[model samples]
Target: MNKSNNKLNKIIDYIRKDNGINNAIEATEQASLLLILKYFYDNSFSNTIDKLPPFSKVFLKGYKSHQSRNGTGYLTLNNIFDERIKSNSSFRSFKKLEEFLALVPFRVHSIKIVEVILHILDEIQVDESLADDYDNLIVSMTNSSISSGAFHTPIALVSALVKVSKPNKMQRIYDPAMGTGRFFVESQKLVKDDFLHFRGNDLSAFACLIGSVNLLLNGICIDNINIEDSFLYEDNKKYDLIYSGVPFGKPSDISKYGHEYHDYKNSLEGMFLKHTMDKLALEGKAVLIVPDGLLSNMTNGFKDLRYQLLTHFNLHSILSLPSGILLPYTSVKVSVLFFDNSPPDEDVWYYDLALNKNINKRTPIKEDDFSEFISLFEKREVSERSYLVNKKSILNDRLFNLSIPLPTNEETIKFDKAQEIAQLNSENLKLFSSITNYFDVTSRDIKVENTDIRTIKSLGNLKTGNNLTKSELLGNGSFPVYGGNGIIGYYDKANRDENTIIIGKVGLYCGNIHFSEEPFWLTNNAISLEIQDTSRVFAPYLAHLLRGLDLNKLSTGAVQKFVSIKKLNDIEVSLPSYEKQVELSNYFNELEQAKSSLDKLLSSFNEGISLLNKNIILEKVIN
Candidate 1:
């Protein structure tokens, strides 16, 4: 498996370096075309070309001729594939292949790159053993180039959703937004039967071609993989099972669906849910991955959608996935919605999967992580991590919110609070003592003549962040959005990583400095500071020094304060030796830690006092 993966990686690397390819998407598309051709060529009998299909024969003959010519051929393989496409008009796979090949920029340089790719593909004979490697390579390439709202569902999440759906034999399964047909591939594993039929639709021709190839590689062939917008495509056929991770934040013009869809025209997810509801056969089940905002957004469209889901369908389960599961593509916190077209149920099961660990490229979600969810999901059992919410409670609420309800237990809560208080109190005492030891570090006398003065420009670079409209912010997301003051909202994408220093750039909060410890989005109202030489000046010390310098006093403008980058760059500061700066930074960090502990200790006291008041009131009422 590793050997096959290495070869696949080589193909991707070669295409990525090729000058003909514009981006990863083009590289991935061209690579998929070559892979499909190679797959067919290797599967065909080289000893007997008479039994092979016309297209396969063309590919084999062309490849053999090219190889015979010492890999230096004036022959264009794309033209050979195009000729086969033109002759085989009835072959759906060939048409789809042509659609993908048409997008590739075939030039002399690209032909050389294709030769290298074919050589790598030739090293590994095509078989069922390469299926997993093919899927992984496609996913890796697709994700590496994912941007502009293009994303594929994680395999771990796909496997978990398939297991929960429990597809049956002979069921007509469908994925409306299937990227590379991952849902179908995962579903094939669970059903292990040839009776199942798979149908898929996608807007991207590249996705259609790659997905068709993926299905063929997995030993599952389907001719109904249509390349069109699933939303606008009119289909009366109902599916037995449907699963999708639809495109996020894309507006759908549902005017063609009639007046009833007017409310959902702006919300693509809402439209998709309604579409899924319409296309479900009697007793059909569906499991969709949607953003958290779809469930909790108080908009009328979202509320109406949730109301229909609760009153009409058997809304079985909602599994809240942890954030960062889609890192490097998006940071949207999402949840899985599992439902069936049966009569409405009185209760809905909710599971909150909190891994308590940072989910990044280094530590991605795994199949093992879903074992507990699957076990408890079968029986709809209520545990610490899983709970049930009554339909009446949801219906009676002013807004039909489907957010997961927290499991409440008084004794458990009290015990947890007591433990938290004790821990915080002990930590606060230790921090107070440690902070006092460094109290005099900042007050130490420094020889002014020995220090060197420098401008902020020499220390680092400062630039404004990307501009985002208020509507672009979500009610809840994985990354916090920072503006002039502090975090004003949340968003699904982050522009900066941890420990980044930000200064407010405009309005009332101009020149306000803040430090982030986690990945966050910086808006245009703030300026991000990137240190050029960390060895010369510590970042934390610089932040503290800037705060002490009172940057707000440097702001200009009559009605509103504005701190221009030019003014910030020209401001001079006296710098001590790197060692002294480190010492001062450490002292300030200790002080901040002590202050945080003190604040937490006070909050705990308030909680304890509130609990005591409640207990006294209860005692008096009982007496």
Candidate 2:
């Protein structure tokens, strides 16, 4: 391994300390940078940092302080984070942290603090022997530009995508805002020294170092990786399999770009797309991780990017990722844009990875709670694939990309001329999806001869659950309550008995799922899906069946998250008579017992893999 890579990893270890920093993004960035400086000093590339300039020393100190404040001092200029939250109520959609985001604009809007820190590092004194420690330090710190320690698209998600949506192989891949080199790392072919091909860029020099190191560690060549602010037209590189998880929001006007683009606060993602196309080799492919707001931003900026993408690339697919992918900090819904440099294809394969559960936004891979989504998306059945009414297919009329028409019918419609004859169809999708997809079925599917749903609805006005002290703990309930991620002890008070069938009032856990009925309490975080109908509704049996169904898509919340009780009733449970409900519930009770036994067997299987230490691979990967 190169001295630089070694140095960076050491610094990252010291700063991150594994258990120390929860955010993965910081660990990668800080580790790489400190290593570079140490490598330069230790390898005799440069003498003491003090041998040169004075300002550089101050930059190092200031950067250290900033990162320590939040351990993101090196590159993230978070001065304006607190201020951005206070901009106004228009941006004040979140009730819990209204003031925090409002202040982002005021505190550290520009990267000046980071720039100064960089300047200082450029001129500071250095110690050669401490290279390893320094490298570890750099990697552990969080970054301001991108949320440090993000839940990147899982490797399984990518591999499944490759299998289902087979793209042309032998094409070069690229990540424009490659933070810690996630997408690239997953693409590297096993048993091979290099990726079939790859390239990437990042704003932070620290991030670049980490990304570069990550690439090298994966056995990919270092020369292919470029560390620079890709948005500034930095690396004149190109590729085919371009995969990126770029940051969102409007573009900034840096003096480096000159004044013509001064008022550029549009989709930074859109700008990345333009850049991706700019450097893309002939017939290159790109899969961009973008925000959902961009899909319907309606701004000319969005329209322009969408139109340009349609013309230059074959818009292959749009996979709308589940919400809460990056939660506890951010709740922005993200989508994947998969396209190729070639002309338009016959049809765009749009899939929705229906991940709607909230995740505890802690670090050290805190996302493990929802991590099961990887397997689910991978298991999503292929074929039975319809553009409209398919059950397994996440993208039916519910998703908007279905707007594009198949040209097969164009000759039949020579006189109709659909493109010019009709208007854009975004509004139609939202309206139809709201009324039909979420509702109608789940609500009206119930057919009662004697008892009405009112019996279940009258469980003495649902009481709220506990008010958690730690906001991060909000998603991590010990045992789930009525909702998707709440626990039993996390309750305020229970007006009803223990056997009450609690329902998820908000999110997808609404219609189905019952809680532990042994004198347990539900959290205010979840609406108790109670049923007063003791005569008809077999709560446990119903909960089991309903739990199988996803109810999050029908949820409705404005600022504070919530689901409608009226809409939740539409779900029709396959209640097999009162005898069957009891028999099935009894059968399920036994099944649960059997599952525990099977779970133990599965647990034993994992024991071997768990015993195999990750550090063992270090020797093979490094040299």
Q: Tell me the whole-model lDDT of each prediction, alpha carbons only.
A: 0.73, 0.47
TM-score of each: 0.62, 0.42
lDDT of 1 by residue, 492-535 (tens): 99998777789998764589989887889999889998888888
Against the true structure, candidate 1 reaches a TM-score of 0.62
Q: Which residue pairs does candidate 1 place in steric collision?
A: none
Q: Best candidate per lDDT, number?
A: 1
List the candidate 1 regions with Cα displacement exceeding 4 Å: 42-78, 82-92, 96-108, 252-258, 411-623
The all-Cα superposition gives candidate 1 an RMSD in Å to the true structure of 14.7
Off by over 4 Å in 2: 1-146, 150-170, 194-197, 234-237, 254-264, 355-623
Where is the poorest 10-residue window by lDDT in model 1?
Answer: 614-623
| Tens digit of per-residue lDDT, candidate 2, span 1-623 | 55544444443344444332323444444434433333222223133343433433533554556656864322432332234222424322222122222221111212444353344344333443333343333223332212343424434445444433333447666677876675665565431444466666665444555555455445445455554567666455667667777676654344565343333355566667667777777777677777776664444655556665655667666666667655433578777776777877544454555433443333222334324333343343232221211211212212222122222222232322344223224333444454453343334333334323332244323444443333334344333334335453334333446766565554323444556675555554455655666687777876776566655556643211345666565555554467667876776666666555555544443332222211222111111
Q: After superposition, how far is residue 400 of candidate 2 from its true place, in Å?
A: 8.9
